[model samples]
Target chain A: MITKDELLQIIYKAVADFNSMQDVDEQLAQQANQVLFSRPGFTKEGLLDSMGLVNFLVTLDDWLDQQESAQSLHFDISDALENKEEALLTIDSLANYILLKNKKV
Target chain B: MSIKNSHILILSDTNQSNFSSYLSKYIKDAKVVTTPFNQLMQVLINPTHAVWQQHYALIIFWANPKSLFPDLEKTLIGKHEMLHVKNFFLRLIDKAERVLFTGFENYPNGFYSQFENISSHNRYALNMMLTSISMESPGVVSYLPGYYSPVVKGLHAVSEDLWYLSKTAWHRTVTDRMASFVADMWKQWHGLSVKLIITDLDDTLWGGIVGDDGWEQLRLGGHDAVGESFSDTQQQLLIWKKRGILLAIASKNDEETALQAIDRHPEMKLRKADFSTWRINWEDKALNIQSIITELNIGAQHTLFMDDNPVERYRVAQAFPDMIVPNLPANKLEVPAFLRSLSCIPATGVLTNEDMHRAELYVAEQQRKNSMTAFSGIDEWIQSLNTVVSIEKLSHQNLTRAAQLLNKTNQMNLRTRRLSEDALWNWSQTPGQAFYTAHVHDKFGDAGLTGLIGVSIHDDELFVEDFVLSCRVMGRGIEETLMNFIISLMTEWQLSNVKVACLLTPKNKPCRDFFSRYLLSDSHEWVFDSKARFVVSGIQCNVIDFN
Candidate 1:
C-alpha cells in the first residue's frame, strides 16, 4: 500500500509534468499547495478553470492506475464532474477520495 | 529552439495562443503564425498578407463547422458557405508544402440538443471526405479528428468555461495532444528518424552478468519467466533490426565472455553477427558510444542508447544530449512496453529498398575498407574497383528513397532544400524539369542509388535546382563524374549554359568547397560555359544508361 506522502509526491510530479507541456502560470503550478489552488471552488480567482480541473483529474487518475499498489483504483473524473461532487474540488479532497476508494483512508 | 528556416501557419476559429504555445514546446525553431481569431476568410482572399508571403513548412486549419456555420442544419445557404470555405482551404493546400485539417469535436448535450443527430452525421461526412482527399494526396494533406468520439464522450473536446472566459475552445489536453501529433508529422515528413540503437549487456540483455553467471547460468532464453523476459527483449531488438534500424553493443564486460555467450548460447536470439559493431571493454560508456557513432559515420541526433543502469544512462545523456537514452523499467516485465513506447523505433512511412539493406551496405563498406590497404596508389585502387554508375529518371519505384536522400542528406547537398515526397513528385512532373538518380556499385558490392540531380531548363539555359551526393561516397571522384554527366546532358540538349544553384547552408560546407574549386561562379550562381571543355579524364567509373 502507498502512503499519503508518496501519493502527494506522485500528484505533484504529475502536475509538474503536465505544466511542463502547458502554458500555465508558473506561480500557480510551482506552489506547494498547487493542487488546492487549482481547484474550481478554492477561490473566485482560481488559476484552473473547468478544463484545467478535468485535465488534472485525468492525469492523477492515470498516475494512480500505473502504481502497483493502486492498480485496481479507478476513479471516473467525468462522472465526478457531472455529479458536481465536492470531493473533486481540491487536491486534498481528491487525494482523500482516491484513498477512500482504495480503502487506505 | 524551433527548427531553423521552418514556419507553421495556423488558421482556426478560436484564439490559437494556447495551441501556438504548445506547438512551440515541441518544435524549437518553428516560427508559428496564427491568423486573427475567426479571420480565415480575410486572409484567404488577400494573397499579399504577410502570412501568405512566408514559406510555411506546415499549414494547419482548425475549425468546427458547427461553430463556424451555426445554421448549417436549418439553411442551405450555410451549407454552401461551408463548401466555399472548404474549397478555399483546398486551394491553400496547393500553395503550401503540407496542410493539416482538423475535424470538429462532438457537440456537448446542452449546446445544440435539437440538431444533435444531423450535426453528428454532417461532422462524420466532413471527416470522411477530408480523409479521402488526404489519402489521394499523400504527404500533402493530413486530416486529424479533433476527438476520438467513442473514447471521449459527454464533455466534448471543448471546455465550456474556458471558451466563455478566453474564447479558447479546445482543452489544454487536446492542444497538448495536437502538439505531439504535429511534431511527429513534421519529423516524419523531414526524414528525421532514429537510425541506430546502442544497447548495454549484463543486466540489460539478461538477468545476470555473463562474467559471474557464466554462459550457461545466465538468465536468458529459458522456460523461467525472468529468462523469457530477457529473451523477449532480444526478440524485440531483432524485430527493430529487421525494420532497418542498425543495432550495436556498448557494454562493460570481458570481450571474450560476452562473445562466447552471444556466439554459443543455445537460447540467444541475437548472435555476434547481428550487431554492426560492439564495444565490450572497461571504458567510459559515453566514449564507447561516441566511438560507435564515429565509426558508423552517422549523426548523434539519429542514435538511441539503452542501458539498465541509471548511472550509465545519465552519463551518456549528459555526454550527448541529442542522443535518445530511454530510462529502463525496474521490472523486467515492463521492458516490452518500454521498448514499444519509444518514438524512435517507428518508421515514418518512408521505408525504402536501400533502408532495408542498410546493414549489408555497411558490411560492404567495411569490405571496401579492407581492400583499400592492398592497393599502393589511390588511382590504382579506383581503377581496379570496377565501379559502375547507373543513372535513371525518378519514378514511383525509387521515389521514396529519392525523397529520403533529398531530405536527410546534408553534408554534400548543394541547396539543402527539404521537400515532402508529394511536393518532390509535383516538382518532377513540371514541364522542362528533369531529375536523375545515380546508382553506384563496385567489385565489392552494390552501393545502391547514392546520388541525385535535379535541373530545370528555361530559355535555352539549364538551371541546376538540386545536386546532392551521399556522404558515404564522398572521398571518391563520383561528384566529378556526376558533374561530367550533367555537362554532357546539357551539351546534348543544346543548352547555352549550365547554372547551378549555390545556396549555402551551415552543414553543406563540403559541397560549397567542391563548387568553389571546380565551377566558376559570381556570387550565388555557379556557371559552366557550354563552350568550355569539361575534362572527365581520370574517373574510372562507367556511366550506364538506366531507363
Candidate 2:
C-alpha cells in the first residue's frame, strides 16, 4: 500500500534528519538528489561514501519499519547495491526501487 | 547564559569540519577555531603564540594517536614523545579558562596485524596517563570519552573510504553522537543538574487504572509479562529516589482510591512515604505541578514532569518551557527504555555522605517546619531545637563536598569563585591559608557540612577569600556564627584587622547585605572593626585544627 510519492517523502525526511544531526544547511538537504554523485560539505566525498551510504540506508530501514503498512517490507542495502546498482544511481532511483520492492512483496 | 557569543577553540589532528558543524547546532553563535590538520605538536610546543592569545570560553583537544603518530608502537622515541605530549597538555591547562581532552579510542584487532597489540597497549597507557594528569590539574581540565562501539550488528563507526576522501577519522554517525556527548559535558560543567521528578499514575505507573479494574485486577507486579513491565518502571523510580532525586505525583484521579492502592498494595515497591508531595485532584496538571515546585522551593528548570498522554505533556511544555516534559512511548512496554534515556541528570563525581542521606534530610526539613508553631520567638525556636556547629579543616574526607558547595551554592556565596578539587587542594597547601567546613546538627537531624570559609593571612590582615553557606541553613543565624568564628581566629593569630572580599552578583545579594549591615566596609573590602559591638550568642561551636 506504499505509493512512490509517500516513499519519496519518507526518504526526504530521513535525509533531513541526518542533515540536521550534522547541522548541514537545509538547502543542501533539498538538493540531495542532485548531489548524490557530487561531493557535499557535510560528507567527506561523494554522498555514496561508505559512512554516508550506511547512515542513510539505516535511517531509511528504521523509518520503513516504523510505518504500520510497510513493516513486512524488507530492503537490504547490500543486496540492493549488488543486484541493482543502477536503481540507486540517484535519490529518485532509490525511491523507485523501494516502491518496486514493496509492490513485489 | 546564552553561548551565542562564546568562542571555542578546537585543536585536533584530523579534519574537524564535521565536529564543528555538529557543535554549531547546539551553540549557534559559537565561533570555532580549528588548528591545522596534524599540527597538534606545533601548536602545543609554543602555546604562547599570537593565535593562542585570544580569549576562548572553552578549548577542546581532540586527537587520535593513530593519526598523530603512526609508528608510535614500533619505536622507542615515540614513547618518549608521548610523555612530552602529556606534559604539553599540562602546560596548555594554564592558558585556557576551561579545557577538555578526548581520550583515545582503541582499534579493533587484525587491523594493524603484528603491531595490533602493541598499538592497543600504547593507546591504553597513554589514555590512562592523560586521565590522571587531568585529575591532578586544576578544575579547568576535564576528560571526555570518545569510544563508540556499535550495539547493532552491520553498523560501522569508522569508514576507511571516508577517511581517505577528507581525512575525517571517525564516521559521520560517530561524530554526531560525540557532539551530543560533549554538549552534555558543557552543561554539567556549568552546574546545571535535575533535582526532582514528577510522574503521573494510571497507564504510566501501571497497566490499568485502579478505579476501572480494581486494585486486585490492575496489571502490576505479577508473573504476567505486562504486569512485570509496570513493576520494572516503579522499581527504576524507587532507585532514583534512593539516589537523592525527589519523586512526586500529579495525577487526575480519586485521591482515596490512589492512596489505598499505593499504601495497601502488596506488589507496590513505592509506599505512601516515598513521595515528598502529591496532587491527585481534578485541577489542571500544570497548576498541580506549579504547586509542587513552589512547595519544594526549587526552580522550574530543575524539575522534570512525565506523563503518558501527549496532550498533557504538550500542555505542561507550553505553560513552563523551562521545565523538562519528556514525550512518553505509545506502548507501555517501552516505558523502562524511555526512562533510561534521560540524560538530564548529571553523573555524580564523588558521592558525599550528605548525598546518601538526602531523602532522610528532606523528611527532617518537613518535621522542622511542622514544629515551628510551638516556639514564641525566632531565637527560642532555634534554641529549643538544640543546634550544634562542628568545624573541621579541609581534608580528603570532605574535599568533594566542599568543591560541590563552592560551585553550586549561589545565594549566600561571598566572592563566588568556583574552585575545582585540585585548585582547592593547592590553595590549602599555601602558607598561612586556612580552610574550614562547618557541620551543623539539630534536634531534627544532622544537616551535614553546610558552610565553607577560606582565610589567608597577608601581612597584618587576615583575608577572607571564600565564605559560603547552603541556603537550606539560612535564617538560623548560622552566617553570623561563622563570621564570629572567623573573627575569633583573627584575634587568636594577633592579626590587626579582618578583611572580607565581596563579589556582587544578582543571586548573591543576601551575602552582600550581611556584610554591609554588620561589618564596616569601603568600596571593595569589608574591614571588621575590633571596637564594634556585636552579639553572637545563638549556637554552640567547636573548632578542630588539622594543621
- Candidate with top DockQ is 2
In the range B109-218, model 2's lDDT, one tens digit per residue, is 44333224345667677778777876775356777554443221234566543455456766666776677666655655555567788999888888788788778788
Query: Model 1: what TM-score?
Result: 0.74
Candidate 1 lDDT tens digits, B474-536? 766678778877887788888888887778877888888877766554355677876654443
- lDDT, candidate 1, A14-83, per-residue tens: 6776666665453245333434333345453555656456556655665666777666665666555654
lDDT, candidate 2, A1-105, per-residue tens: 767677777777777766666434422254436444333343433445444555566656667767776677777666655543555556777777777776787
Please report, in order, the local distance difference test score of every candidate based on alpha carbons. 0.74, 0.73
Docking class of 2: incorrect
What CA RMSD would candidate 1 show?
7.9
User: For all candidates, what are the clash counts?
Assistant: 6, 0
Clashing pairs in 2: none
Off by over 4 Å in 1: A1-19, A22-105, B1-4, B10-16, B34-56, B60-95, B101-134, B142-164, B167-174, B221-225, B429-432, B457-461, B517-526, B530-547
Q: Which candidate gets the maximum lDDT versus the true structure?
A: 1
- For the second chain, the TM-scores of the candidates in order are 0.81, 0.82
